[model samples]
Target chain A: MKTFFTTGKGICIVGIGIGITAALLQKLGNPPNMGVCVACFVRDITGALGFHRAGVVQYIRPEIIGFVLGAFASALISKEYRPRTGSAPIVRFLLGFFAMIGALVFLGCPWRALLRLAGGDGNALLGLAGLVLGIGIGLYFIKSGFNLGRSQKTYFSVGLVMPVIAVGLLLLLITRPELKTGALFLSTKGPGALHAPLLISLAAGLLIGFFAQKTRFCTMGAVRDAMLIRDFHLMKGVIGLLAGAFLTNLIVQQFNPGFTGQPAAHSVHFWNFAGMLLAGLAFALAGGCPGRQLFMSGEGDGDAAVFVCGMVAGAAFAHNFAIAASPKGIGPLTPLFVGIGLVTCVVIGFTMRKKI
Target chain B: MMPDRIDARGLSCPQPVVMTRNKMDTSKSCSFEVLVDSGAARDNICRMATGMGWDVQVTEDADECILVLSKK
Candidate 1:
């Protein structure tokens, strides 16, 4: 049968699938307006691994493991599992690190931004605008002939590395292995504490992974395509996602329709936008959003795995240094970090441009 | 004049926009009517029409929208 996943309608279906799944996950006990934040989940994983001592945001999220495993399974079935690496690995890693820092500063990634808006948090508008602006800047770099060196196909075992790591994580989650004293760091409160049942979350992640791999659904790509090519093909999925989540939120009575007191959200607007601006630029430069990076990792992209590791480290840095924002407001050093991220990204963009 | 019509309801964005564009590209008629179920599709189609120098008239219903595009 012809693949419908790449078609507009099929992508819309994928969007609706993700939207409904996220809403349902929230109803089933994931955080409000945050059913599937890749950045936050990765941060939790970092903490759970004892990489960070952030007491509240510590858990071995099964959904993330499911994402990798699910994509791996889909790739294997489809014969798309070619192992590849060596495309500006260190640069991608730094981009991922900065991306996570920016995302945490904004308290969400691109996916969570949409979900926040769909759930009626007005604060997301600024962040979305910032994201667009950041993508526009990255597009400028692209138009200027900036390119990450091409990745070469690597050995088959390279492809299995990410999947093996995911399986190992799954094993850890299932065994609840002792970390120092008690079982792996499980948060008693905060976003990490709020979670859907392990199986449900994992299944949801797997389903999304399967579809996302088929569709190549990336929020950063959607915006990039729209800005760079004036093409709405990918953005149709984004619109569908927003509409789906909005409808689902309304149905579930999770739609608050306000600016303040939204769950896990702060009223600070400037930092929100600025933070995501940094994040959007990083994502664009890195060639994928966080979720997309995870999916790519699953598909045997060793470079994306490196980016994932960078994000985990970035999360560690954020909490340990108090650079991540809280629901109360921006962190003390968030501005400085955002500035540093912007400068770092701009330097990379300028230095990496090919002489044409 | 009886305008050409495209029923893009139940279709996602870009589909509606694509169908409308295809019709505009192939037809001799300078006017068309498009029906879309979602606001996003309606807006996108309207933008595409306007970008192509067509005048657009939008009518919003409870959960759907209708657009009429004519040469300006």
Candidate 2:
């Protein structure tokens, strides 16, 4: 039952599409080396909602909204929108929660890691190592029978929740409410303040979301499949991403290499590695990368919706508690937060397995 | 001889793979037949079983995917 999009070549096109879109977005005005960062954008959106007072990083990114809505549209069009829930929702939430903390520590998610590498950031090498190692640990658990149980089929409305939220957010973005009390929050400065043209960003998001849904493009899944089963089906997409981004960056002349002054990135090498490691483990446990989770939410997965909510809340906790990293360095409470996340993930991995 | 049967249909993701892993870890038999409805699940089981030094053969009809795995 494989369609044209499911083939290796097809998924490669999807990956290349995402790479080119992300690079193009950066060239268009998004942050350098950060065209479409899910975790970072989610944090910005969280800040924009006034969930946190991180002034430098608060804006309602249209790309995220478009991503969710686009995936929703694709799912509906393809008749693949199946509502599912009840697969340890709280644990899933916590996984997403810690995953965010981990990602923020590194200042990006898996896709951003690849993008950073394409932008010639040497720091991304360490982050990639951390991601691989973390996912490797999670693979150990998987080999030893780690599982979070199965999700049951739920109502159709359950699946529509995230998309509905996306629509509301789009409206809020359009209206541009002036409220000191609540509702919408926009950043006046910093990375959050920088963005590409709204319509173009949305268009890119929709295109990426549409093809990603069809091809099942997942960064974590690509790494996991490569490590665990040695199947390169999804890995091909990952390579396409790197190649596409690298070429685009070369064309745009944004390929600056060095660790001294990379944009929107810090050189705290240990934390960078540890952060992505924690994120990798969390993604492995949670069953998908952050963007994949968003796409799943679009496709009516209530479980993924819960995970997404957990991530949004995690962004708040990271900033409000001052645990997330900045360009200068790691936060004051980063070690404490990341330590707790690592131990918690290990406990979940061990305790949740179906032994015997 | 007959193989151990693992019906992983209706399950998603790591569950199917995890189920197969646990079964492979605990069972005495060297062969197994796993039933899965989703392509992801079927591929997961096939890969895990094959990686554990077993040969895997996959058969799919309209309803489900059948993975026949054996150690030789």
Candidate 3:
């Protein structure tokens, strides 16, 4: 069958669908400016699993489960599933770790940056600029032939691991498995407490997963392709996403245009940029956005699964160390950690370049 | 004779480029015109057209551009 979703118009529709759904999810109480954030959702999942003791940001987000499962289902139906691994797993993990840290500092990922902007958070501009700058730097490394090495095909079970984990998480979410005190913490308030209904959230995630899998959607990829090859295909989808979300926010009366008082947002402009700069650099090095990583994990990429695990661990570290920023403002150690992250990424970029 | 024209204004990035590419691919015409809203899209389409062995002329407007491509 001819796949319409892979075409330019189809991708635009997919972008619109994602944007509208995110806006609707926000209206349905999934937190303002945070209708769907892969990094934040993963952090919440990490907390729910008791990986971190952050009391205010613990929940088993079904959207994440749906992302993996939905992508798995799409891959299965399309016969596109190819389990693979062994591509500098440790480095990928470190990249994911720093990516999560950067995201936490900014309180958003690339996807959330656009969502925040569409919802009228002017502060997102700085973060967006940082993302572009970071990606531009990553492009230089790419031009210099920086590679993480090649991945080899692995057993089919390797591909099923992430999906199985997702299923296990969904089961835990549904059963509310009683654990001893301090075993599994549930947030009673804050961003972790904010959620759309489980089924609705799962459905939205599944739809996005299916479409994103078909379209190979990635915000980082969009920017990379534009800068490296002057290709605008992916950028069009991004523009579509922004336009769709903006229009939906306007219709829903959720558009609050300002830099201050945006939910789950901090107005410290410099850290916002620096945070995303770190995240964008990490994502470029890792070769996909957080959402793309999850999608890849679903399709049986064990390396991507490793990266996902690194993100979970990074989330724990962020909350435990008080490095994550809050709505009030930047954390005390944000600058220090962001500086470290930038140095680390630059070192990797330089050391990993293949001598041609 | 008037050349075929595609007014892809207000369309996003690749859409404008894709539309221009599609028209060029399907038509046997030697010359055509495409109107786009963004500088990026205008430049991208021109690059693609040039790579495809087409002569290109771009006329800029306030926030839009018209690219005329002739087969080389």
Candidate 4:
């Protein structure tokens, strides 16, 4: 097969797709500044699975399923599908968990952070700052040689693991599996209950996944590249996405600007920045943002897959225990979780480095 | 002037820009053709090109785009 799309190209294209898709979603009736948020969607999925019982945020998002399956398809076609594991799997899992915590605290992911800004959410300014700070910290680790140990290529089945899990979840979603009398694990209402047509969401995801697989777009990486290397290649794609979305939103009359009353966002500039800072640091340390992580997981990276699972679990824990922040303020347990997440990230940075 | 066109078409967000920058420093007056499938990449690349003082012309070819730039 011929491979024309490199990793960087894939990210740019995928970012564009996401930008377009988000605008479409808003036009088609989803919330503003929230066309596609992997973290928020996953949080809703967690609620759908009855993990969080947050009545307002539960739903089985088909777009997520499409993200994984689409990535899997692309990986398979590109012959880049290499399943591997065993580099501090548990620690990676914990990092994934805390990463979500940080994102929830800020109310957005790296992609969403950028999207928020494009849509005129001034709160994103602080979030973007925080994201940069967080990634800067992670860069320090990289500079100091904080390695997660190289992943050894494992059995092909290892990579298939996430796809299988995704398929099972799909089945459950379709069948409404009655594992318990009144607890079948599905979102009936709230943000989780909201959905675009499954086929539409799935098709969009698959197309994005395929393109993302081809291009390898990452929001965190875009900022990281610009900051660390004075490079703007990936940042260019991000600009494209923002520009596309901005135009689309303006055309569609969805370009609502402000720090307050933004859909699925809060006005806490410090936390917004801090939350994304933590998330950015985590993505930098882990080598990708949540969206990129999902794509990697689909491509048979067990570590990435573990990270996705960790995000889902983290979302569950956040809502179940009141750790995820809302539009009003930090959730009941966010302070503790954020503290732990920050400490853990710091510890990982300090300890996991080679003394040059 | 080696007219090198970095087909950042299928690549992700930062990689194209990263690759472009990497190539830019070495090449003088070369045409860097950046093909992006999304408007986002195209716009960002265009802005960056303008900011860098490159003569940029964008042509759309069926959703995929080509940004031709002559370096200063």
Please provide, for model 3 over B1-72, each residue's C-alpha lDDT reduced to its tens digit, 9 standing for 90 to 100: 334988766442334555676678788788888976544356567667876789999887544578889988
Off by over 4 Å in 1: A181-183, B1-72
Listed models, DockQ each = 0.02, 0.35, 0.03, 0.04
Please provide, for model 1 over A206-274, each residue's C-alpha lDDT reduced to its tens digit, 9 standing for 90 to 100: 998888877778898799868764867678788888888999999999999888998888878998899
Residue A221 error for model 2, in Å? 1.0
* Interface RMSD, every prediction, one decimal place: 14.3, 3.0, 14.7, 10.3
Which pairs clash in model 1? none
lDDT of each: 0.83, 0.86, 0.83, 0.74
Checking candidate 3 for backbone clashes, the offending pairs are A159-A300
Q: Could you give candidate 4's per-residue lDDT for residues A94-153 as a string of tens digits?
A: 788988989989887877777777788888888888888898888777666675654566
lDDT of 1: 0.83
Q: Give the TM-score of candidate 4.
A: 0.80
User: Candidate 3 or 4, higher DockQ?
Assistant: 4
TM-score, cand. 3 vs. native: 0.83
Please report the candidate that would top lDDT against the real structure: 2
Say which candidate scores most in TM-score.
2
Cα deviation of B57, candidate 4, in Å = 30
Q: List where candidate 2 sits over 4 angstroms from the true fold.
A: B1-5, B18-39, B42-72
The TM-score ranking, best first, is 2, 3, 1, 4
What ranking emerges by DockQ with the best candidate at the front?
A: 2, 4, 3, 1
lDDT of 1 by residue, B15-57 (tens): 4555677678787887778877543456557656776789999
Q: What TM-score would chain A of each candidate receive against the reference chain A? A: 0.97, 0.98, 0.98, 0.93
Is 2 or 3 the stronger prediction by TM-score?
A: 2
